[model samples]
Target: MFAFCADPKTLEGAAWFACYLTSATHLAMYWSVLTVMLLLALAAPSALMFGFGGALMARSHIPPLAWVGKGYISMVRGVPDIVFFLFVPIAVDQGLEYLMHVTRCADWTEPVRRGADFVVCPQAKIPQSTAPAYVHDAYAFALALLAFALVFGAFAANTLKGAMEAVPRAQVETAEAYGMNRAQAFRRIILPQMWVYALPGLTNLWMILVKATPLLFLLGIQDIVYWARELGGSKTQVYAYPHPDWRVWYFLALLVFYLGLTWASERVFARVQNRLSVGQATAAGEALRKAGAA
Candidate 1:
């Protein structure tokens, strides 16, 4: 910020605007974008891992495991995502707190659910009552991340399970004929081949996750959406830089940001799919071979 920015009250026009934009609150707003990115970066891989586990469970020989996996996939599909987004964090938080309460306060006589209140001892509170403000925020964010992962993972599981099954039965039969066990055949043939099939659905899910980042506001995280609303509200003469409601512009910026993210991700995923198909027995690979021969 320039020296003139030191006296914001006396500043006007572009100088005042620049100063305002570079203020502490605005800096925090800028950093929140990175927070969103960090969440996506961390959550995507975690969700994929969860999805892989779920898919394996669905394919398990154990009937109960298969049932549980199938139920998880189906339940998520049937419910509206926003409902899960709202419910998952609260449920996970309370569940954690409840477990802690039972462990830490074994002698407490009070029932946890006394008319809709989830009462837990102060010692069992996540981040603890004595913890700093940011600790509470971080704990909340972690819960939100878990919620996002669980919901998205269920969808990913369904996609992966279908993809895994879509890998040619003939391939598995050949592997078995060669004395390969089911596990060996799955590891050597199915896992690698299934990815080409799964990539499309997974890419779509990634886009959906990107779009859903705005829901961080709903989770009480101070994300871009929250900052947009806060900064874009009308400011009166009582403030350093009085302005009318500019929410439309703020939202428009968010739209552009998301559009850019999706567009870039599409380009990246397309290249990855092409690379993954290079030596495969798929139609895309066959086409590439034909082109190379020509």
Candidate 2:
């Protein structure tokens, strides 16, 4: 920000525009881009971990565990994702508070759910009623992250399960012939090989996750979509910065942002896919071999 930014009202043309853009609200809007990035950064790994666990469970010998894993994947696939996004935060929040309420409000016997209202004692409030605004925002963001992880993890689980099955049955038998147990064979042969099969599905999931970031607005997070609407809406002369509706321009920027992210992701995945195919039996591997010989 320059000295000229001191009096936005006095400035005109480019100067006025610069001062307005650098204003507090606009800075917050700019920061919303980082919020979207943070969600992706945090959510991706968390979702992957969840997916890995689900996939492993689904592959387990134990019937109960396998059932749970299969059920999770099936349920998530069967349901709409927006339903999960809306339901999870409220459900998790209430579940946490209910546990706290049982412990903290044992003596207070008013019904927590009386017909339409769900009430918890003040002490059981997440971040407490008196906490700072940032704490509230952080908590909401965390809930949104968890919801994203759970939903995407199911899809990831399905992808991983399929990949695991796609590994050659001969490879497992070969490992056994070499005196390797199930666990050893899985770690040494299956795990390494399955990733190639999984990469395409995972790449697609990443793109879907990138597009899904806009749903953060539903979770009360001040994401880029929310900022675009807020900042691009028309403001009158009564406001310090008055502007006409430029929502089309704002959304165009978001469209470009998502496109850029997807393009980069595709390039990265293509490189990874080629690298993984280097010594495999697939067509890609044969091409790579031919290319090397040439």
Candidate 3:
């Protein structure tokens, strides 16, 4: 970036360091931080959608729907998250391929399971073997996003369901007494009040989600952790700006990045909670009311 950076091989000290950090590979490395942030930003809302559906299903009047929702939430809770992180994408991928195979290869009678192998028609391959590199990367990212959403959604569903139930029975009863039906009471009374109760758990889930971004490396996504490992290793003299083993420093920078992310998220969530609590009967709202009067 600077005049001295014109000859990276001959430069030393701060000059070489500056040029090294500005290299194309390092630029991609920097961009990977944004990728992590984007993943979180996208995943949070998607997970909330999944959680809302799951929570609603759990509360469904239909016995089978309730069982499915309850089972989804409970099964995920007992399993190690890492296991699901690994399993979900592969399972989803294969399931998609299997459905495609059945439809696209209707005349074929080959069993999908041949011992350890999963055989499917070439047309059934996700992204297809002929697709470009970027398409493959996008496919992988989509799967990763789904895995994140599904895992976190289960936790969110449990929290939301509990929060829904925690809304006072008296409040719902009064709404009904005032001629509101179950659906009306839920929409006007229960849904509005549940946020305050759910905020604490949802905030904790956000922190967990932030920490879990590193696991993207395991899923073959070139996230910040992957870039750190790549750029922080020792470089040879053949490279323009050779360096020593700097993995420790790279990982340290990542640590700071995550710490800052969590700290900022905490501040934002706290502000949101305060805003949502205003005029509510919660302890925080009550306290705020008293303090404002004083």
Candidate 4:
């Protein structure tokens, strides 16, 4: 903020816009972009880990474990994403509070589900309803991240399962025949080969994940979309910086932001795809080899 910003009504043209942009609220809006990025950065890996576990379970020798894993993948992916987006965070939060209530407030005799209000001992409340602002924000973001991970993880599991199955059965058997155990064969042959097949599906998943960042608003996090609406709404002249409805411009900025994100993501995935295509038997690999030879 500048001295001019102290009385924003006196500012005009670029100066007015400059001060407006640098206001504390605008800075928070800008930082919200980083929140989206952090979610993606964290969620992608978490989803992959969950997917890997699910895929392993789906293919497990134990019938019950395989059923549970397959069921998870089927159930999550089969359900509509919006439902999960709305449902998961609330369910997880309440579930956690309930568990804590049992442990921390065992002596409390009141029913938790009191006429549709999910009440718990105040001591068992997550963040205790009295923690710092940042703690509440962190708790909300963590729940949103978990929702993303669970939904995306199921989809990733399906993709990975197909990729794993796509590896040739003969090759696996031959590798085992040549003194490699099942684990060694899987690590050396199947694992390396599956990526080329998996990359395409995984790349699409990444894009979908990127697009879904806007859903943070539904999860109680004050994300960029929330800021855009708050800051871009028309303010009357009674306010220091009066402005007409500028939501169009704010949303246009969002459009450009997302387009740029997807553009950068495509370039990254393309490079990764090309990198994975080197020196293998697939058509893309063969083409890459020829290109290298030339």
TM-score of 1: 0.95
- Residue by residue across 46-78, what tens digits does model 4's lDDT show? 999999889989988899999999999999988
Clashes of each: 0, 0, 0, 0
Tens-place lDDT per residue, model 3, 222-272, is: 888888888889989888877799999999998899889899999999999
Show the lowest summed lDDT stretch of 10 residues, model 4.
1-10
TM-score of each: 0.95, 0.97, 0.93, 0.97
lDDT of each: 0.91, 0.92, 0.92, 0.92
Encode model 2's per-residue lDDT on 96-176: one tens digit a residue.
999999999889789999988889999888879899999998999999999999999999999999999999999999999
Query: What's the residue-level lDDT of 92 in candidate 2?
Result: 97
Using TM-score as the measure, name the better of candidate 2 and candidate 3.
2
Whole-model lDDT for model 2 versus the true structure?
0.92
Write one digit per residue (lDDT tens) for candidate 1, span 55-118: 9999999999999998888898899988998999988889899999999999988888889788
- Which portions of model 2 show Cα errors greater than 4 Å? none
